[model samples]
Target: MKDAIFEVNNVSFSYEEANEKAMDQVSLSVPEGAFYAVLGQNGSGKSTLAKLLNGLYLPTSGQVLVCGMDTADEKNTWDIRQNAGMVFQNPDNQIVATIVEDDVAFGLENIGVAPTQMPGRIEQALLDVGMLEFRERAPHTLSGGQKQRIAIAGILAMEPRAIIFDEATAMLDPQGRKEVFAAVQKLNREKGITVLWITHFMEEAAQCQHVYIMEDGRIVMEGAPEEVFSLPEKMQALRLDAPAAARLAHRLREAGMPLKAGLLHMEETAKEVARACKLNSKA
Candidate 1:
């Protein structure tokens, strides 16, 4: 567990005046430099878990830690937030500056980054996300994908070791979604940043190193994409959809095509189907 950057222990949470627990005794560990995709239906504790990571919400009973900094501790709160930055659902809500570079540098400025060093950090952040071309452009003129990438640039400028994306692409179109996902993957691969992508998109989740399926505030299942999604019936029971390829494989199996499950990509599924047909013809 040396690589574990965040640890949650018997965490439970509920609104001060709410009737039911939003998150029940949920626990997990996130490793540094790993891309973890958290999926679930509504009220399944996905967002709540994201909040707990950065000390946005203290556990009602148990403990949550960011790089060993406890979320419930008042003094360590700043450390926790600094270690794990969060990107919320709405990109506009996270944007502050009219210009792209300024917005990206906003976090560094707030943390008292020396004015002399701001330029290099800002430039690097934008360039990393492929937004340097529009550094001087007004954010309002940019597309959703552009805006979201800019928002992420702001966080990256802070140089956090990890990030939690809570449905960050929920508001974007297909192209925008790809842009966001690509940026995230780039960060994980190029910069070695730990990424916790909380989303419902099976395709997006398929890109992760690991996937956790949650339901009714519990982690019903967790594993690699092929291990978890191979059981279509289990994923269906959790109210989670499989990736396009996995779904096609499921349909083919149902149709008596005799293809194997656990197909996370179209190429793999197609190859399996082709093999089945080839063998059938020989028989």
Candidate 2:
């Protein structure tokens, strides 16, 4: 029961009154307390899948289960929402209140957290995200990273079982992006929160426990990061980028060097290069 938090079984989706299905027979499962990254180009159904997990959109066919709660059933909708919360791409769009504390308190207020409990909940939420000092500050005054953290704090106040980041770093500068990603990773490591992160960034995708690649509204590949991203040519065919290490190794192999597949980081590639150089010297 604790191993799998989300189960999407052959799910398909079409926008309201639309002709084409946005998601076509897509399915995947996210394990509890795992960091999973979804990668694809624009309109690849990654965003649509994230929404289904959080109950923003119901599946047109098949099922999306969140901790045994079916999202398609209206009775389980509220409970499903409380269990899985979404943090979107734009920080500005997620800001509902002018002040940081109000933003964090918004979700709790909606669930009608008792008056006596609101203060403790809000404070703990901020503290968890390391934003307690900024609780009184205005939302607009914070950095992009800080704003996103507050948005997440709002959801954390609800004590969700998982968090979905839908291209949450797409709109920020490099520093801001790093801040947001770091904060999210910290929470997952310390709090054991399952994270379903959707992004096109290859570097970010490489950090996850597993990677799922979508194409034309379907999952084309799913595997551990090294296994999935190591194939540079295939990733390019899917209109996706490969991690730098994998790409570099691919090029080296193309130039007639003997190299293994799926070297994802610089350190790993460096070791390979040194090993090859020593072998050449011995030969």
Q: Which candidate comes out best when scored by TM-score?
A: 1
Alpha-carbon TM-score of each model against the true structure: 0.95, 0.94
lDDT of each: 0.88, 0.89
Q: Model 2, 160: alpha-carbon shift in Å?
A: 0.4
Q: How well does candidate 2 match the true structure in TM-score terms?
A: 0.94
Angstrom error at residue 230, model 1: 1.1
* Per-residue accuracy of model 1 over 1-283 as CA lDDT, tens digit each: 4568888898889989987888888888889888998988777889988987888888888899889888888999877778899998899999999989889888997888999999999999998899999999999999999999999999998899999999999999999999988998999999999999999888888878898878877788999998988888887887777887998888888888888757899888888989999999998
Poorest stretch of ten by lDDT in candidate 1: 1-10
Tens-place lDDT digits, model 2, residues 174-262 = 99889889988998999999999899998999989999889878999999999998888888888777888888888888887788777
The global Cα lDDT (0 to 1) of model 1 is: 0.88
**In model 1, which residue pairs have backbone atoms overlapping below 3 Å?**
none
